[model samples]
Target chain A: MSDMRDMFVETASRLFRDYCTPDLLRAAAAGSFQTQLWDAMVEAGLTKAAVAEDAGGSGAELADALALLVPAGANAVPAPLAETLIAGFLLGEAGVVVPDAPLTIAIPRPGETLRAVRKGDGWLITGAVARVPYARFASGGVTVIAETAEGPLLAQVALADCKIAEAANLAHEPRDDVAFNEAPAQAAKLTTRQAADVYAMAAAARSAQMAGALQTVLQLSVQYALERSQFGKPLGKFQAIQHNLATLAGQAAAATAAADAAIAHAEHGAGSIAIASAKARAGEAASIACNIAHQVHGAIGFTAEHALHFSTQRLWSWRDEFGNDAFWELKLGDQAVAAGADGLWAMLTAAA
Target chain B: MEALSFAPPPVSEEAERVRAEVRAFLKTELANRPPFKKADSWNGADPAFSRKMGAKGWIAMTWPKQYGGHERSALERYVVLEEMLAAGAPVAAHWIADRQSGPLILKAGTEEQKQSILPRIAAGDCYFCIGMSEPDTGSDLASVRTKAVKADGGWVVNGTKVWTTGAHIAHYMILLCRTAEPTANRHEGLTQMLVDLKATDGVQINPIYDLAGQHHFNEVVFRDAFIPDSAVLGKPGDGWKQVTSELALERSGPERFLSSFTLLVELVRALGPDPSPAAKIAIGRLVAHIYTLRRLSRSVAGMLQRGDDPAIQAALVKDLGALVEQEIPEIARQLIAAEPDTKSTSDFVAVLAHTVLNAPSFSLRGGTREILRGMIARGLGLR
Candidate 1:
């Protein structure tokens, strides 16, 4: 990372540490968006951190911006910050002006065509969005891939124009279903990627988020082990608990490494295998890490009053959001099989 | 937050180039290698095969060129090591010397020792064995009672070293012996002595076969083995420090995770491209694990190359690696119904059999899981 990237990370870290408190997270979970937190992040230029400078935003490198997601997610900042960054990038690419409001992205299922035809002065959009993150709270708009008469295009459509049946994920954040029946869309940019690329992008982002959440839960578990005493000793002193925490640490490290691999490969072009590996590995890590953390925390972590669930619940939700372990496992395993025994080595080594 | 830092280190383009070359070489070299032999990974020795690697300057890769090394970067060496392990190359003949012992000599041995021994090690012709575990010592390495009394020129050693891998085949042993009486600190007064296995008069090497009847482990006893003044590695009392310093070098590597890689390759082969969703998920889990482990292992390599001590990180890699590795056979057991048989000609069954028998020792060697967890706990500031 360059000095500028380091500064960006430091600023984001300090901001989250100062503002993203447990109270803020709890309030955000209870159906209230944290405007002050989002405003602070926006003022810091982090909201448009993924957009191009020529498109009117902080033009941080893709990998650099993605890396910041780790610390942001680690802090449990309780906002649609990553969504806004991604949405802003997509909007900027289409020459659309990014709004001051918070943003969310809608991921379509694999191989379902989205159509937008010319209607009056605007475009008529027809698509069904499932598991749309922050759909109820995307104040700026939603970034979606739709098929127009001009072929596939990345377009920005407002939330108010679409019919949304709001839902929530395991973490209590919005995962609404949005139906765009001839909803007005504009400033669309042409794209070549399919639903798979969208899945990869979402997977990459979620993998980073999972890495951050797992790291925090590991810290929580370790802290709990150090404080909670039984049998005349701290839990950390017991070999069984120590081994469990050690295993947790290993899982956390693996998750972090997988995320890093995704970020690094994103530095190159179109990260396919790296994204698959990241999502699959990080999801597995999240499963192991979350289970061990809860086990280590005992009954304390099960309560809503405790903060461990803030991260663990988010991990549970995020692992399945973009593409779950089973979803990506087939993709990677299929690729590995097609690669054959001879091609497997090349695929593994090609990441370098 | 400051606990075990395993940030995936960046590899250079040079390392990637090295990877391509290594892969191409392995494709040609291992085209006809049997799956059973490949399943042994680093423990399967072939002197001729090792020499082939030596001819390519793949051994002692990160060492200085004067020591018969290729003068490659640590990341470059890492690429080579991982590619070999993944391909199940027979690297046992030079694995120890290239991975740890030669590096120890380079770090702490005298110039004369470096010139005399490191070149042979780098050449891949000279094999070395670890003499850390005594008959009474396993994870309690500090409890070693092997003693060497001060003599005319240097010392006369007498002790029994058990579970010494490759003792029957290795040319030299980096033996750790107590030079003085153990005080409150058992690690105190210990010394590392270079032993010539063939030339040593009082040494006896006896086979200690494992459950699978492999010949790697041995019990070597010395009655009155002579060590000259130049044979001492590092300072006498600093043996503990020296041995522990080289541990991260030994623990974190592709070998730790890639021991079961052949089984994975065979699993993939058996499943073909279109297995059931259950099989895909199972294999994908293993793929995810191996990929993550490889990244962690590479990060350790980067740290080692930068001359940093990543002991805690190495422990984490080894422990998690063993867990996933040991789990491979179990998972493969469910994914495929073939009965494991070492004598079977079927690649999948043979590799599965080989891995099932050896999986128990993954955590047992390179410090047990309990010990590694203890180290990790200390790293986390828990102890």
Candidate 2:
């Protein structure tokens, strides 16, 4: 890691640690936008970190931006910091002025379509994207790459112009259902990228977040095991609990490695295999880590009030987001199959 | 949480350049070998092949120049190792010596020992087997009953070492035995001694065939085998520390995860291009795991290169790598229906047979899963 990246991580972790309190998380869970948390993030210039300076934002590299996602996930921050960074990158890539407020990117699910048609100077975008992350709170508007008759077009549509049927993920983070009906939007031709690229980036983002959450889960489980006792000894004294925590530590390590690989590859120019394999491995780690964590924590972890759920719920929900483990695994498997027996080793090594 | 940190491995141009050369060599060397034979991988001992590797200056790659080493970086050595394992190249003839024993001797050997053995090992003419595990001791290594008593100008050793891989073929054995009586600390009073298997008197090696019916393991009985004073590896009563200091290198490597790689490669060939989604998911998940394991393993290699001991992280990799390696055979059977048959002419079936039989040893070797997890738990401050 570069000194710049280490410094950024230190700053971001401190900001998150100080602001993302349980009270703020609870308030956001109870139908409140993390206005204060998001404001602090913006005030720190983090919201513009992934955008280029010429694009009216901070000039931090894409990797520096992605590195911040780990701390965000670690604290279970009740805001779309990852989404905003990704949206800023995509919009900046399209030569659009990056937004300065909370932003979200629109990735259409299966059988869903978001289409854009030229309307005078701007384009009109119509159709719905299911479970668009934080769409209800995207004050900077949602960045969507909708299909057009010519090909695919990039558009930025305001939340007020679109109908947002509010929804939430497993952690009660906003994943609203947004529908657009000939909404006035600013659309441009994406000469350098496509919608699939956005999906991969988002998946990588989720992977980074999962890595962070897994770390927290491992820490929480170990701390709990040491504090809680059964049969006159700390739970950690038992071989069973120790082994479970050991497994959790392995998962956390794997997830962090996977996420770091994905971020590095993405920064070097995204290799589809690296991103795909990362999301797949990190998601797999999340599942195993969550199970072991909850098992070690026992009933206290199952309850809503326990601090463990903050990280665990985020892990459960983030693993499903930006395409699940099975989804990325199938894609990677298809690549391997296409590479065939002779080419599989070459493919994997070449990506490395 | 503090014990676990696998930073991304740094890329090395020199390592990448070495990778191409290694691949080209493996391509020609393994072109005619059948997949069934290739499945043997590092377990397939071929001294002639090992000598070829030595002639290429590929053995003892990271030692000092005077010790017949190339003085290359650990990253370069890693690239060579992974390439060999991935291609299922026969490396067992010099694997243990190159990976651990050679480094151990270099680190703690006497100048005489280094001059006599280091060059031979670098030339791949000398092989070494670890004489640590005894009949009564395995994971509880400090409790070893193999005893060595002081004799004239040397030590007289008497004990049996079981599961000593390559003991029959290895020219030397690094024997870990009790040099003094046990005290409150079981880890103390143990010492490492170098025994010349061929030259030593009253030392016998009996073959122990694995389930795969291969003579990869041996039971060596030393009945007062005289090891001269010059054969002592390090200071007396420091065997426990010396042996354990190498665990990170032993536990973290591509070999841990790439053990059954031939099966996966053959499975892809059998599945063809248009297999079921289930097949893709299984293959893809396995690929993801191998990729992640490689990252973690490489991170450890980098740590080793930087002179940091990553024993806990290494344990985590081995434990996880073993899980994935063991899973391949079980998962392969479900993706395609075929009884594992070593006699079958089909590459997939034969590789499957070999892999299934050998899968159990992946976790058992180096350290058992339970033992590694215990180590990790201790690293986590649980013990």
For residues B1-383, write the lDDT of model 1, one tens digit per residue: 55557766765999888888998899899999998988887998999999898889899898898888888899898888888988888999888888889999999999999999988887779999999998789999988998999999989999999999999889999999899899998889989988989888999999999999888899999898888878899988888999898788889988898888888888889888688988877876777777777888888888887888899999888998998899999999899999899999899999999999999999999899889999988888788
Q: How much does each candidate deviate from the true structure in C-alpha RMSD?
A: 1.7, 1.3
Where's the lowest-lDDT run of ten residues in candidate 2 chain A?
A263-272
Candidate 1: what lDDT? Answer: 0.84
lDDT of each: 0.84, 0.88
What TM-score does model 2 achieve against the real structure? 0.98
Assess the local accuracy of residue B376 in candidate 2 as a C-alpha lDDT between 0 and 100: 93
The TM-score that candidate 1 achieves is 0.97
Candidate 1 lDDT over A1-352, as tens digits, reads 6666788889998898899788988898899988898899889988888788887788887667777788888988788877777778667766788887888877677655567888776667788978788888887887787876676667788778878998999888888888988888855667775445765776787888888888899899999999999989999988888888888888888888888878656533234777778888888889989999999999989999999999999999898988888888887777778788667767776754
TM-score of each: 0.97, 0.98
Least accurate 10 contiguous residues by lDDT in model 2 chain B: B1-10
How many pairs of residues in model 2 come into backbone collision? 0
User: In DockQ terms, which candidate is top?
Assistant: 2
Which regions of candidate 2 fall more than 4 Å away from where they truly are? A187-189, A267-271
Q: Write the per-residue lDDT of candidate 2 for residues B173-244, one digit (tens) a residue.
A: 999999999999999999999999999998999999998899989999989889889999999998999999
Would you give me the overall lDDT of model 2? 0.88
